[model samples]
Target: MSRPAVLAARLRTAAWLGWQIEANWADPFTFIVYSAVRPLATALILAVMYRAVAGIASSGQAFLGFYVANAFHEYVIRVLVGMGWVIVEEREEFETLKFVYTSPIGMFTYLWGRSSVKFVQASLSLLLILTTGWLILGLRWDWGAVRWLPLLLSFVLGLIAIVYFGFFVAGWALVLPRAAISVNEGVAAALTLLCGVIFPIDLLPRAVQVVAMLLPFTWWYEALRRFLIGHGASARLSSFSDGALLAALAVSTALFSCVSVWGYGVLERRARQNGKLDQARLF
Candidate 1:
């Protein structure tokens, strides 16, 4: 096959594998139900906690808006992490690591296709959360006021950044199966606390705020929030301008992509040298 044809075939295979995994695991209704319930339940719990801490009456619209917006962003992060975990699960539980490691299309391309499918799934989950929040929790956003062009651009850039982040995590999963679990969990937790998901980044300590600015999640969340809500509502902890934030996101995504590619190469080399690709456990 031609190089482009081979690449297309591999991507198609990756997407098909993703669909089969989803279908075999659960029916459409069940998948939809779980996705809707899990995020919504978590959001409601957080809403109650926020109200308890800040006082329901005192918290007001601004708090609710931020919370709801953050909840949606959090769902996106979780789904992205979940995409990495799917790769890990296939390696460990299904014992398919060897085949994937030796595939003609390469592990990196396979993961890209799989994560692309997860991105679509996660987008659906985000829509569901938004609709549920609007109906059940009285969450409101002025859809008409939003700059649609910029918002679409932001969504594309943000999702691409996040999908690349998933690819990075997938590389870790390839080599450090057990550690990858903790890594994914730690990342999710850290982003929640540091990325201005549920709270303004400015509220975090100066040292922590500095760290948060280095992460793509912080910028992605801020950009999405700014587009969805407004600049005033999505205030940053750092003194960076809007142009700076977008530029950081682009740079961060590109950096992570390079790192992920390098990491995959390292894992492949190590696996070949140590004969660990087919081994059930490293430790």
Candidate 2:
């Protein structure tokens, strides 16, 4: 097979391998049920909190929509982080990194394919959350009002950005075998706190807000809010036009992708030089 064909084949095989590894413990029906319950429970908590705090004077449901959307889209962060953390899991626990390297597949193809399963699971949770919100919790979105073009554009850009991040994570894990767990949690927490997940970026300290602006997640989330709710959660960025949001997402994700790919190459070289490819250091 040609190189592109080889990469495509490897990605498919890796994705299937990842799916069976993650879901084999539960039958398909049970796995779907279990995944559905966790996000719904979180959505319920956000709903109750909104009720106690705001009580229906929702300024046309902005915060209600914001928090609830945040609750349900938990998959975004989990998939992003899980993509990074998989390096540790497969390399250390399964003792399979060297085999994959020897199998002559590009690591990038392998990782992206493995992460696809998380994206699938997360998408399912998001669908359930959106349905429950519209039916039971009053999320205030109109299917008619959604800007499908911009929404899909931002969504695809966000996923591409996430794949870049996963590559960086796997690369760093190659070098910092001992700090894999800490690195995974630290990246996840940073996204959770600073990427405008729980609150708008404008509400963050001005200095921190600058860092947040550099992240693709910050732009991606705001773009999503605008596409879904007709306005964004950030007052500071409200003046930015739709064209500007798309431009910012494309530019920021591209820059970040460059940085991630560069960092990954550097780290992977370092790891190979130091003989850390199959090293495990959980302790």
Candidate 3:
């Protein structure tokens, strides 16, 4: 196929696969209960904590904003990380990895569809949390048109990062017979701990903070905080800066994604050569 033809085909495949994954989104009650619960609880806890602190000191909206942004961002991360391992779920249930290995289109396209759908599903939770907090709790919205561009950029970047990370997990599952469990929980826990979810990295010890900075999650979270909070509001073209940040993040995500996907392909192909692909099964 011509290069453009191939690209179009991949995109179509991605769309089809994305729709399939989305169709499996949790049922109404499950979606509401699972997606909204944690963030709602977190928001409430932060509200009380902030109210206590503000009682004795000057009142500020920064904490409220930061809490909402970080909590929402963390939920995004959860979606990204979890989507990475869904391939394993398929492998365990019906040996779908073999089918993926033999598929006509590139694995990346199929994976993109699946992960993108899952990301949307996971993000739904945050949407509920943020909207409820913003409208019901009287949290202020900055209402800046252009200044909020970075927020969208960060979200896109975070999504891309999840795809790259998912490649590593999928590759591990392909190469190591029983590696999916560790890949799933290990990546999830490591990201949650290091991504400034529960606490910002600045509050951590110097050494731990340095290590956390090396991971992609920190950058994702930091960019999210800046974008959602209108970091460049003082600038004349705050909206332009927001767009620029989004563009930069998009490029970075593409670069990392290429590297990670290439690495996974290499490992998966090698596993096939050695008859180790079957080891990916749970049984």
Candidate 4:
């Protein structure tokens, strides 16, 4: 095959491998239950939190839309967690990392291809969560106020940054296989809280807020709230125009992806040198 054809074939095979591993792990009924329960539970948790703060009356309509934004944000967590988690699984659980490394296809390309299944799974979860938010949690649409430009830009760029962030986790996992178990989850939880998953970064401590401001997910979530709900959770984010938000997301995407690539190379080389790639220890 030609170069582009070979690349496409590698990506396709990796994606297919991922799908079999993910979806064929159990029977169809079990798979259905597994997929539906977590996202529904997540929606319920959001509703419970909303009710705890205040009753779901006229005033709660604002947070109902916030639920919409939160539903879409689910994919960010999925991508962030899935990328690195796969590395741990392949290395320790499946004993395939050394074999994968021996393949002609680049590791970065292989990992990205494997994560294509996550994008599909997250899309399904997004649809399910959005439905639950609308039907069970009082989410509603406001088409007139939606700003398509920043919304689209943030979604596209934010996803890029999220995947690269996962790549960042995967790089470290190659060397620290045990810590790999929790690395992506740790990263996801930290970003989810700090990046304003359901709360404003402005409410976090000043130093933490400053840290959040520098992350791409913060810009993405802020833009989602502003454009989708007509405003954000804080004045700092709400005051920025669509162009500003997109520019921040774009710039951060570029920077984060570069770091992800560079860091992955460094760590992968170290793993190769130290014979860490094939080590699988269960504790």
Q: What is the C-alpha lDDT of each candidate?
A: 0.68, 0.79, 0.62, 0.79
**How many clashes in each candidate?**
0, 0, 1, 0
TM-scores for all candidates: the values are: 0.86, 0.90, 0.73, 0.93
What's the ranking of the predictions by lDDT, best on top? 2, 4, 1, 3
What's model 1's overall lDDT? 0.68
Give the distance in Å from residue 265's predicted Cα in candidate 4 to where it truly belongs: 1.5
| Candidate 1 runs further than 4 Å off | 25-30, 56-59, 74-79, 232-240, 271-273
Q: Which ranges of candidate 3 are over 4 A from the true structure? A: 1-32, 35-62, 74-79, 176-179, 231-255, 273-276, 280-283
Instruction: Report the C-alpha lDDT of model 2 over 68-162, residue by residue, as the tens digit.
Output: 44753565655767776788887888888888876767788888888888888788877887777777765666668989999999989988888
* lDDT for 108 (candidate 4): 79
Clashing pairs in 4: none
Which pairs clash in the backbone of model 2?
none
> In model 1, which range of ten residues has the least summed lDDT?
231-240
Best-to-worst TM-score order: 4, 2, 1, 3
